[model samples]
Target: MRQLLSYGLFGVIFFHLFFPHNISAQSVDTVYFSLDMTEPISEGWLKHGTEIVGIRGDQSPLNWGNTFEASDPDKDGIYEVAVPFNLHSDSLLVSFKIKVDGVNNPDDGWQKGRNHEAMIYQGVKNKVTLKWADEPPQAPTTITGQVEIFRDFQSDNLVPRDLYVYLPPGYKESNQRYPVLYMHDGQALFDASEIGQEWRVDEAAEELIRAGEIEPVIIVGIGNTQNRFDEYTPTEQVWRYELNRISSQERTTFPEAFAGNYISTEGDTIRFKTKHDTLLTMIPGGQFWQPLIPESEHAFFLAQAGITFTFDVKETEVNQVVASKPTMGGDGDLYGGFIIKKVKPFIDQNFRTRPEREFTSLGGSSLGGLITLYLGLEYQDTFSNLLVVSPSVWWDGQMIISKVNELPGATNQHIWLDMGTAEGEGAVESAKALNKALLNKGWSKENLNFVIEEGAAHNERAWAKRVPDMLRFLYSKN
Candidate 1:
C-alpha cells in the first residue's frame, strides 16, 4: 500500500508518495535472499524479513520501515524474497530480522537484541543463503575481572552516554588505586551482542595484570553516539581540491565549446561551478555512468550525514571544495574535551584514580586513535600516557603531523603507535612518517613505542591481540 503526500519548498509544491511495502522494484540493483525454515515453529507463527533499511547496508534506519514479504514457493518451508536498491556505497552493512506472524511482542522475534549482519557487495546481483538462527547472539566468556555497565551517564560537556568500567582482579578486595585507560567505541569494544566482533579489552587487561607485565589498571570504555566521526577528529572542517590541476596541454581533453562556462582554469587547476534555486538534479540518462571524463576525474566521495559540503569560489569562480573536517566535536571539543574536562573528573571523583597525568592514559583505534592523540597533546597537562592503534594520520590531509610538530621539545609523555600490514601500504608509510616526526620533535626512543603487526587487519580481534603489548608499554612501572 502507498499513500500520497504533499510538500512545498519556499512556495514550490510537489507530491510525494510513501511506500508501505517493498520498494525494491524501483532500485538499480537487487539482493535475492533464500532462507531455510524447515524446522518446526518455535516462536513466530508466521515469518517475514525485516532489515536495517538504508541507502547503504548499515544498521542505520535512514531508509527503513517496510518489511519485505517472503514465501516458501516450493512448499519446502524455504522462504525467498528479492530486495532491490542502489547500495549506499561499494558495500552494505545490514542486519535481518525474522518476525512472527502479525505479532509485535518482545519475544515474538529471533535474534532480537543481537541480530545477524550481512555485507552486500555493490554492483553485483547477490544470491544470499541463510538458515534459521537456532540460538541468540554468542555470549562472552567469563574473564578474570569484572565489567560494570553504567547507562545514561550525564555530562554537561557531552550528550548522555554509557560507560563500561573494567576492574582488574582483587580491585574490590584491595584499597589500591590504579591508572586508567579511556577508550572510545564502547558499544563495539566489549560486547558481541552489539558488534559481531569485540576488542575484549577486559580480558587483555586482566591477563597482563595477572602476569605482572603491567600494573593493575582501570579501563573505561566510553560509548559513542551516531556522530562518531565528528566526536573523534579534532578539526571542524577539511578543505581539499575536488578537481586536480590539469595541464595546459590537456585542454583538448574537455569540450572547448563551454570552456568559460562549464569549465574554467584557475592558474594550474581546472574548475567547475553551478548554482540552483534548491537542489541540483542531474537529468535521467545523463551519461553519468559512462562519461568521456578521465577515470580519475570521475572518482569522488559522495557527501552524507555528518559530512558537510560547500563550494569555495574566489571572485565568482568556484574553484575549491570545502567539507566538514571528519572528526572532533565542540562541547569539550566534543569527545576529547568531554573526556578531559568532564569525564576525567567524574572518574577521579567516583573511582579510586591516581589523579595525576603520569597515571592517566587515553587510547583507541582509527578515528578514535586520532582523537586520542589530539586529546593527549591538547591536554598534556592531564594525560602523560597515550596508546594510539592505527591512528588516522591521513585525516585532514595529514594535518595531525602539524599538530605533532607543535609539541614542545621535551615532555613527560609516553606514546605508542601501531599499525597492521594488512591495513595497506599507505598505513605503513604513514605510521613510519608519524614515528619519525615524533622522534624529530624531541620524543625519546624509550618513551615512544611503534609496532607493526604481521598479517593483521583492522578490527576488534586484531586490536584485542595487541592489547597486551599496549598495556605493558603504557603501564610498565620501573
Candidate 2:
C-alpha cells in the first residue's frame, strides 16, 4: 500500500508535468511537454529571449487548509500546471524553477534526483544533464554532454531507476567505440559533482584510461529499482515456509500466513537487535529521526507482537502478503530480461562500447551486488566479470549462499567481492561462505578476490571511497 500510494502520487505528478501549461484536448497548440522544465534550476537562471509561455502551480494539495496555492514539486521542481493560453510570441521566454537542493535533491521519488541548487547539483553538472526540451539546449561550449535519467512512469514498475553515460572529452568531434563499465545504481555511484558522492567515476576513468592503468571504460550506472528485493530475488519470493495459526477459543481467522524470503533479520542478527524500529522524519526544514519506541523494551514488545510471518519464494504466497506488487526495491531478489538485455544493450550501444562480452563487466553493491552475482553466474555468456560489494548476503533467501557453489569456475572469469567489517557478524559469515564456496570450486586467488574493510559501513561514502579501486580491479589491465 505504501508503494502503491507512492506510485499514485507519481502518476498525478507526471501527468501535470508532461502537460505543464494546460492545453485543451482539441486545441491546435496541442503538445505534451510543450513548455517543460525537466531539470531542476538555480535561483538566478540567465538565458536569452523571453515570453511568458504559461504558469502552472504544482498539484500536490493545499497544505492543511492553508490555501497554500502551490507545491514545490519534488521532481525537477517545475511546479507542474495547466494553462489555457500559449506563449505570446514566436520567441520563448526563459522561466525559472530556482531551487536550493541541500543534502537531498527532491524528485517525485523517481529518477536520480536532487535539490534545486545545492552545492552538489551546481557547476560541472550543468554539462552532465540534458534538459528535456523540444530540442537540446544550445549549451555553452564548456558544457560537454547532455544526458537524461529515466524510469517507468507506471505503478507496476516505479523503481528508483536511472543510468549515467559519459561523453569522451572530445565526443562531438569523433565517433569512437569506448569500453563500458555497466555499473548498478548509476544515480548514486558518481561523485557529488553531479549531486552525488565524490568517487567521480568519469574523472577517475578518464584519468586512468588516459594513463593506461585501465581501458577507457564509459560507465553506465544503473540505479536500483525502488523495489530492489524484487530485482535481486530469482524466485517470486526469497524463501518459502508454511504458517499455521489458531486462537484461544480454537478459532482461527486464517489457516496460513507468510512473506516470501523476507526474513526477520532482527530476530537472528545482533546488529539489527541493537538498532530498533527507527524512522527518519524528513520535513521541509530539516530531517531527524529516533527509535519509534524505547529500545530497552523493543525486544520484549516485538516478542509479544509475534506477527506470524514466514518467508516464501512463490507467487501464490507473495500475493497473500502483498495483494498488489512490491512497493520498494530489495524486498527479495530481481533478475529479468529488461535489465539483462534491454538496459545492457542501451548502455552498450549509446557508449559505442566494444560489441563483445570479453570487455564487458557487471558490478553493484548490497542487493545490487547479489543480483550482479546472480546475473554473471546465470548469464556468463553476457557478463564475464562480477564486482559484488558488501552484498547483503544474509538476505533471507540466502540467495548468494545458495548459488555460489554452482558458479562458473574462475578460469574463465574474474570476481571482485568485498565486505566491511563494521557490518557485523553476518558480514563475516557471508564473506567466509563465498570464499569457501569459490575455493571448493577450484577457483584461484587470481580469479577471485575478496576484501574486508575495517571500518566501512553500509553507506554511499564507504562505497564511493572504494569505487576507484573496484574499477581498477575490474577493468585495469595493470
Best by TM-score: 1
lDDT of 1 by residue, 1-478 (tens): 0111121110010011112222333234567777666553344443322111112121222122223445664666677777664454576655555543223434523434455566778677777776665434575644336888889888765578888888888889999998888888877666766656678778777777788878889988899875676778777543332322232322232222112212212222222322321112121112111111111221222211112224443443333333222444423266776786677888888889898888888888987888888888888888888888988776655667888888777467999999886553356778888898889988887989989897565566678889878888887654
- Please write out the lDDT profile of model 2 over residues 112-217, one tens digit for every residue: 3331121111112111122323232332222123334555412233453556666545555667776666776665655454432434566566666667787656
**lDDT (Cα atoms) of all candidates against the true structure:** 0.59, 0.45
Evaluated against the true structure, the overall lDDT of model 1 is: 0.59
Clash number for model 1? 8
Give one clash count per candidate, in the order shown.
8, 43
Candidate 1 all-Cα RMSD: 13.5
- Candidate 2 matches the true fold with a TM-score of 0.51
